[model samples]
Target: MAPNVLSIAGTDPSGGAGIQADLKAFSANGAYGMSVITALVAQTTTGVVRVQEVAPDFVTDQLVTLLDDVRVDAVKIGMLANAEIIRAVVEVLDRYSPRHVVLDPVMVAKSGDRLLAPEAVGALREQLLPRVDLITPNLPEAADLLGEPEITDVEQMPAQAERLSALGAKQVLLKGGHFDGGDSVDLLHGDGVSEFLGSERVETTNDHGTGCTLSAAIAALRPQRSGWPEAVREAKLYLTEALRASERLEVGRGHGPVHHFHTWW
Candidate 1:
């Protein structure tokens, strides 16, 4: 059967990021996509203007309702807007114990608007991190978790990935996109293996939902692959092609989205 993947995230009405990107990535990866929106974000490719969060009880209801029916194979978690929502997600994961959980530590948008509340960071660490199979954090998000300003170089990623792994995740995929270089390298550390996946950086301002896309694709690929490393590798390749195709599309005034359906046509 195709992987049954769920995205627990916010909504980007402009269709560039959040659940929109996740669902598209899931479909492109040949997975059955599902979603539970944590918040309704008012934004385009330009920036996040405002946000309306869903009630925690409703979020729990959504999770229970879905888990009651669908046979979820993997889950992609993004943008939990508050501590309550984080707790709600934790509760569901504890109950169902999905096969794979891809946690995207989505703290901020590509435009620098904060997606997660500052206070909720602690809740996420305590409640969600331990339950996830893989935690994918960009340099800035990793820095936030580690109480550092930012991870400045690729050399530091291994140590940070190790630190994050120690925090309870089974694996860590530290994305090195912010590094000043020609290639975007990612470090995957866990399961007695440390590997780096690198791809030539595609020059484009339209890289909005790359993080969400990568994590969701990984979740979609997780159940089908032999191991987490192969899932990460395939996701990276898919995202690279998506980025290359995204460079040509004109979507908005500011940073646009990577083409999640790039492989389709």
Candidate 2:
């Protein structure tokens, strides 16, 4: 049977991110993808205007119903709008114990709109971070995880990645896209080692939903026999190529979506 990955995330009407992006990434990479929505985000390229969270019990029901029927090889967790949803998902993870879990600490949208609640940050750190197989955080999100206001230097990202691992993530992928430079480098810290993945920075304002895409790609690749490191590297390569192809595409007036089918058959 083919491998299967699950994405516990939100709904994006624009179809640019959340469960939609996760499923697309999985299918794009030849894996089956499933989802349990945590929230319904009213959003567009310009920004997020409002959010409606799914009830915690209903969220649990979705996970339970799916896990009961199929075996999940990996899971990608996205927006948990509140503490209740965080706890609810944690319970399911505790019970079913998916083989691979990717945690993307989605605190805010690229447009500077808050996505996760302030209080749920604590719940995420305390309850969810330790359980997942891998945690992916960009520079700003890394700072939030450590409760530090800023990561002044790109060199400091590795140390912060270690700190995040100590906080209970089996491994950490600390992305360096938010760094101040013309080059974008993403660091993957795992098993007491750090691997820096670099690519030429594509200068464009169409970087919305990057975190969601990256996390989803990682999850989609996670269930392959290649293991986590190779999975992440492949995902990063895909994202880089997509960004290169789409940077010039004028899809929207605001931050544009990635050209996913740039190499479509």
Q: How accurate locally is residue 202 in candidate 1, as Cα lDDT from 0 to 100? A: 92
Q: Tens-digit lDDT track for model 2 on 1-265?
A: 6688899998887777788778877887768888999999998888888999999999999999999999888899999999999999999999999888999999988789998998889999999999998999888888887899768777887888889998999989988887779888888888988998887788777776778888888888777757788998888887777777776567666888775555683
Predicted structure with the largest TM-score when compared to the true one: 1
Q: Tell me the TM-score of each prediction against the true structure.
A: 0.98, 0.96
What lDDT score belongs to each candidate, Candidate 1 first?
0.92, 0.85
After superposition on all CA atoms, what RMSD does each candidate show versus the true structure?
A: 0.8, 1.3
lDDT of 2: 0.85
Deviation in Å, model 2, residue 125 alpha carbon: 0.4
Model 1, span 1-265: residue lDDT tens = 8989999999998788899999999999989999999999999999999999999999999999999999999999999999999999999899999889999999999989999999999998877999999999999899888777787888888888988988898999999999989999999999867899999899988899999999999999989989898899999999999999996678999999898888666
